[model samples]
Target: MDFRKLLLVDDEEGVRRFLGLSLMDLGYEVKTASNGREALAVFEEFQPNIVFTDIKMPVMDGIELLRIIKEKSPDTEVVMITGHGDLDLAIESLKFDASDFITKPINNDVLEVSLERARERFTMKCALREHTENLERLVEEKTSRIVELERQNAACQVVNGLSSALESASREVETGSGLFNELPCLVSIHNRYLEIVAHNTLFEERLGNHVGDNSFDIYSDRTSPGNACPVQRTFQTGKGQRSRETFLGKDGEEIPVTVYTAPIPNKDGEIELVLDISVDMSEVTRLKDELFATRYKYQRLFDEAPCYITVQDADLAIVEANRLFKRDFGEVEGHFCFEAYKHRSEPCEGCLVDKTLLDGEARQRETVVTTLSGERKHMLVQSAPLHDASGRVIQAMELSTDITEIRRLQDHLTSLGIMLGSMSHGVKGMLTSLDGGIYRLESGLKKGDAERVDAATKTLKAMIGRVKKMVLDILYYAKSRELETEAVDAAAFLRETAAVGAAKAASAGVEFVEDVPEGLGEIKADTAALSAALVNFLENGVDACEGRGADGGGRLSLSARREGDNLVVTIADNGMGMDRETREKIFTLFFSSKGKRGTGIGLFISNQTIEQHGGAIAVDSAPHKGTTFTITLPRGPAR
Candidate 1:
């Protein structure tokens, strides 16, 4: 046992000493204090577990000290020592959380008993706290386990529902009965004595007339009467077996019925009963006759349908195709879709068929297919998820429509717009050149100088060349010709385009820089077309930078690099950028921010040319900040 430190506080020194010695002899470490004040000091220094205090003290009363000690350490116990007749003060101490009260003449046995009771109560409190903590932990663990089990049970139910539906369908087909019949079929068995041991509805309906008769009498025509019957054979196999039999009706007509027998197990695992079901096949005979008569009509509807229709199983194997589908793409039943149509050995990445089955929802997708003959076609496909009776998706019905012609029409319209815009721009540039040359010629005629006449003649020839080039561009845009591709170093292309605009940038007092990386990989594109596009972008940048003063003059940066499988070229300018409304319409035909001074064909033509090269162009700009036009083209040498 561990010894607890005990403090004895009293105004009388002799009484304090006596109690201290008694507690020390009782296996406690005891300390004595003369008054309540001294006792509190000793209590702090000694760190005692229990305090024994007298009621009356010189500076502080025992009741006050007990209250202070309890406030400081609520777990510590305090015993009040009072005079023989001071019962009121003892009661007061107890109300102030004193553990126990003892009179002036303290009984040693009562003190020991009170201390033991306090120790026992504290031990029980600790044990209860620990037990409560453990119970809470266990409850939380069991709750989580229950949630997991419920999830598993729900999954199992879905699988079991499908299994049961399939089994029922098989049974209906084997017994040759209507699945929706009210009282479908039943089976029964009897022992050698011919008692009514077991019988199904079908057996009862057929053999009720011979009831109360022996089993051997009804089946006496069969050999080996003592051996296993057909029903017994079914029991041994635990599966249903069917046999054909003819019954003579009351009017002398013969009726044919198919009988099926299965085994029923008892508690001891013995097959004590047999189940029989009889099905009438007269309706089936009529259905076969009707199917042959209408086959031609159904075939006509299947072949003439407008939609590109095909049937596929869960594995996406083609099971059937309509006439239109077979005509466009060769007969592809039983072959994988990617192999037959896409001419690939693998399924298309991000296949929508798999998604439709997993979610059991109708899905639509647009895909580009490269046919076996190297023809690329864009197709829009819609697939309907097909589910079995139990709601499990088993297959998909797909309808694909060719959208290649539509895309071509859209591209043609875009090209037409670009051609008209470019024509306006070229005409405007020519008119500006003519006006400048005529003014210079008129001034030279006043001076009578041959040099000015020669300069004017050269200017006229350049204007004619410009007009011819513009006509050629219009012709190229109108004709549907395959792209002529060649290898061109992108870095050199950017530098040449930037150099053409550098003189103009200097005259306008604007700074221009080429940041393209040297030895940047080449790209496959029409060299003349690509050069024209880059020059247009550079001219636009220089024009935007023109009016801003030398100190506030704009800056232009041209950069080119390879990003992934693309060659990216960026032309950026720190100039007066357009507002949101103007930027939105900048690429539209006849839309220009420069009013009468701009034909707006520069960016629009650039957009078309990049798109033709299988590339994209995007403009990022904000008012008063700057503008950046980025062109991304597929990376490879021109073919």
Candidate 2:
């Protein structure tokens, strides 16, 4: 079978049975043992590639088993299973070369991760061993061939001896063996006089057969006695020398190179010939530059991204933010995202980043956010998880794109569509009333009836007023005009506005109460717009009270006063009050709760006008309870 072999050892019988089955399910040929001693017996019989043993066990513990296994088969991967209390023992197993350790009540995912790691290590060791054996055999064959071919020369004899020693101590060379295989490395032997005695094939090809030449002559900077090359340094120090040096190539070009030199000692323990190796660094330098440029490019892209990008840790703290984020939100690193982005004391409800961190799934949400400048914007927020090599989510990235303009445009288009649909029926009804009034007036005039003519005149006048109000509302919704603000006496402005509402309320049999006081404050406002806006609210109160009719005990109140630097105006009504849903959408464009009598534009324009005067409006109401609107307007221009 193409399955891996695993040995499971634990003192408990249940652990052995359960864990053995789990290992088998993971594509491992599993065998169980009740103790470390029993595990050793099975280890010899099964020769498992991996051994998972509990740290605390009878007869032999996992640490002892690990030591024994490493001594017998160093390539075998041993993983320790220990309780939380036996953590120190598990750590000690690492000293014995155990692959990994897992605590008791082991998680299956953790177990699989450990197994995969052990499998990788086992495969690497096997591959490395095979490579070493092949390399040694190749060196031996090449050495024999060189010995036979160059047997006639004395210098060749010395070169052959040095080559044999180099092959045997290749692992002790300390430099990467792969570099030697990939690059044309210059290797040569220098005598005690710093004169090159022999050289390798690449050395002869690159440095031009420098057998009897001075070793320092090959280096551009070490041509003088004041500066010695790597070979001369090795001879003087009686140790290995490694440094960056420049070599003069055979083509008369300066080549950047890394040089390594080792001293070959004589039988008397004295330094004799020095073996030198130099590697051309042209390709390596280019690769290094390319890697650096790639990293820099990615970092630049991350910093200069158009949208606001923030990397948050598992705790939802902002670890890194892009340039735009820092510029808008201010250096927000180490702060919670909600605090920095939304100005909330805690995390946002159903946060997209939190969802991504939880399930490692990408998510998106549309939200409204306020900037430091107090400008509110609509944002499309997206989140994605950042993972480590083991596929565990380490952090999450949140990207927010500003969609405020898009939402505004959509609202405008939606308002137009709803306006046309809603106003059509109301306009049709008003026109029909106007037509009836005209017919009555014509008939009364022809018959010369004074009472009928007077009644028809009153009806025609009322119908014309309704038609005029509807047209104004349509014009205001179609194009908003800039405010022509001026200083106005709060008491005078509010009283005049309340008088109109009071007459309407009295006509409908509802009480109108006013509380305007003299010398309240001068409010900086667009006089016409603010007056019209306040009158709109007062009229709404009258209409709300009128909904209850004469017997409903309806009442409407308008009050104005000065509170610090603001003028506070309140309009209240005891009528068919609104629920929470109606209150929330009352300010939204083209949203009306009234079935047919309402145009829905009065309150929207009123709210906008109040805001334009740097004022705020708050509404408090509940089902069956009366509605109260408190408007706070600045006494001066907005701060």
Q: Which is the leading candidate under lDDT?
A: 2
> How displaced is residue 620 in candidate 2, in Å?
9.9
Error of 2 at 276 (Å): 3.0
Model 2 clash pairs are: none
Q: Give the whole-model CA lDDT for all candidates, comma-separated.
A: 0.71, 0.84
Cα lDDT over the full model 1: 0.71
lDDT of 2 by residue, 1-639 (tens): 122988888999889888888888888888888887898899999998889988888888888889999999998899999897888888888999999999879899999999989888888888899999999999999998888776746555674576557544443332334343344687777788988776666776777877788989998777765687788788888889999988888988888899888777664456778878888897799999999999999879989988899999998999999988898888999999999999999999999999999999999999998887888989999999999999999999999999999999998888798898988988898888888889999999999988888989988887887788778888987888888777787788788888888877887799889999899967777888887888888777877876687878889999888888888999999877789899999997767776666788889999998998888999998766789999998886562
Residue by residue across 1-639, what tens digits does model 1's lDDT show?
A: 233888888888789777778888888888888888888899889988778888888898998898899899776678888886789888978899887887767788987887787666546655677899999999999998999899878756654554355335434433545442334443344432433354434545554433443433334243344654555566557666787644333344444556665554444434554444556444455676778767867777767877577778877788888888777677889987767767778877876776787787888988777654567888898888888999898988777888989888987787577657655765887888888788778877888887997798678776775576456545654663566788787787767777876765775677988887887777777877777777777767877776677767689878888888888889888888778898888777545677645555556666777888888888998876788999888875332
Error of 2 at 616 (Å): 5.9
Q: lDDT score of model 2?
A: 0.84
lDDT of 2 at 226: 61
In model 2, which runs have C-alpha deviations exceeding 4 angstroms? 1-162, 165-182, 186-213, 235-239, 248-255, 262-275, 282-286, 303-421, 431-464, 474-482, 488-521, 541-595, 611-634, 637-639
* Residue pairs of candidate 1 with colliding backbone atoms: 187-275, 187-276, 188-198, 188-199, 524-638
